[model samples]
Target chain A: MYKVKVYITLRESVLDPQGAAVQQSLHSLTYNEVSDVRVGKYVELTIKDTDRDLDQLVKEMCEKLLANTVIEAYRYDVEEVITQ
Target chain B: MYKVKVYITLRESVLDPQGAAVQQSLHSLTYNEVSDVRVGKYVELTIKDTDRDLDQLVKEMCEKLLANTVIEAYRYDVEEVITQ
Candidate 1:
């Protein structure tokens, strides 16, 4: 099996209200030194095969459905997992 | 600085169309053994301070804004980074 890790984040110039809210909460909780907080998403997937061609497949998936390249950016890493 | 990693995934019962599409792509790419694909999100945040109270602050941040606890589930790990 293969494990894929995907990270999605808002475009750098875009304002992240959710992240701002978290920043505010951190300050209120006495973590006043915290100056910024940007929140994003992490997803993990397990696929049943591990072939040389799998990389292209995963990349196509990321482009078509796994990510919205306009508003967000995504990166993924695939690794083979050993089974007992 | 402290680095926070957040993972968000669809609840077990929710159908993940995006993930399904990716799975199909994998099969078409000759990864016929691949049976399932679920997509989620990953976010990373760098906080400016690391005090004993930081744990509580980060948890609150995750609960209120970093994650949608109802439709999604999240877990985070806090680590201190050394500056060169």
Candidate 2:
């Protein structure tokens, strides 16, 4: 099986209100050194053993549903899992 | 400076409704090979240069807010940023 770890984040040009709120919360917590806080999504996908090209399949999945390319960008790491 | 990438996810024992929803969506899209979808949170923390022990600070942050030890688990990657 293949385990794909996907990370999706708002584009640098996009405003991140949730991030801002978290930043403010941090500031209130006295973690003043923290800045440029950006919040994102982390998705883990487990795919059954298949012959399809993993890269193409993951990219298609990201483009079609995992990520909103218009405002967010996504990247992934794939690892093979051995089932005993 | 340090850039910390944090990934927070529900514990294996915990149920993930968002993940199930995404799994169903993927199935509808005909990605039948996909399974075991888990959804999580991705946070990017930009920390200013400091003399404090980074490992300790990050651990505290995760325990205090980033991860709910009761039901969520978190891991992080820290990268040193060379500011020119």
Candidate 3:
């Protein structure tokens, strides 16, 4: 089996209103050192072993379902899981 | 400056319906090799240099505002950013 960690974030050119709100809230609560904030999604997937290429499968899933590629970019790390 | 990456995830005991929905969607799209899924939040913060301990400050923010400690757990990584 494999464990996949995927992170999807807004593209550099895109605006992230939610992140701005969080930053403002932090400032209100006196965390003024925070200068910028960006909010994104993190997904963990446990996959059974497969003959198909793992990276290709993950990319396909991210493109087709996990991420809105028009405004978001995604990257993933895959780890092998040892099962007894 | 420092770049802080925070990941907030539901505790293992809590059920994740959103993750289940995504997994179902993936199965419908024929990615049958996936066995489990969990969805979480990723927040990136750009922090100005401060005398306060960086890790403590981040942990405080996560406990006070960034994460719902009742149902979620958060972890962070801080990397120093050099400005030329």
Candidate 4:
């Protein structure tokens, strides 16, 4: 099996209102040292071993379903899992 | 400055309905090799230099605002940023 960890975040040019709200909340809570905040999605997928190229498959999955490529960008790390 | 990357995931014992929905969607999209899926939150914080211990400060922030500790578990990675 393989474990894939994917991170999807807004493009650098995009405005992240959710992040801004979180920063504001932190400020209200007196965490004044925080200068900025960006929020994103983290997904973990467990896939059974397959003959298909893993990296290619992951990229296809991200583009087609995991990420909204218009306003968001995604990256992933894949690792093999050892099962007893 | 310090850049902190935080990942908040549901505790292993908790039911993740959002993750289940995502898995179902992926299956419908024909990614049948995927055996399981888990979704979580990824937050990036840009914090101005502080005299406080960075790790402890981040831990406090996670407990106080970033994560709901009752059902979620969080981990963070911190790196120093150099400004020219």
lDDT at residue A37 of model 3 (Cα atoms): 99
Task: Write model 3 residue lDDT over A1-84, tens digit each, in one string.
Answer: 999999999998999999999999999989999999999999999999999999999999999999999999999999999999
lDDT of 4 by residue, B42-82 (tens): 99999999988888889999999999999999999999999
Location of the lowest summed lDDT over 10 successive residues in candidate 1 chain A:
A43-52
Worst 10 residues of 2 chain A by lDDT: A27-36
For candidate 4, lDDT tens digit of each residue in A1-84? 999999999999999999999999999988999999999999999999999889988999999988999999999999999999
How far in Å is the alpha carbon of B61 misplaced in model 4? 0.7
Most accurate candidate by DockQ? 3
Query: Each model's TM-score?
Result: 0.66, 0.97, 0.99, 0.98
Go through the candidates in order and give each one's C-alpha lDDT. 0.72, 0.93, 0.97, 0.94
Tell me the tens digit of each residue's lDDT in model 2 across B1-84. 899999999999999999999999999998989987999999999999877888888888888877799999999999999999
Task: Give the clashing pairs for model 1.
Answer: A41-B41, A41-B42, A41-B43, A42-B41, A42-B42
Give one digit per residue, the lDDT tens place, for model 3 in B12-48: 9999999999999999999999999999999999999
User: CAPRI band of model 2?
Assistant: high
Candidate 1 TM-score over all chains jointly:
0.66
Can you give the DockQ of every candidate in the order shown?
0.45, 0.89, 0.96, 0.93
Residue pairs of candidate 3 with colliding backbone atoms = none
Q: C-alpha displacement of B61 in model 1, angstroms?
A: 3.0
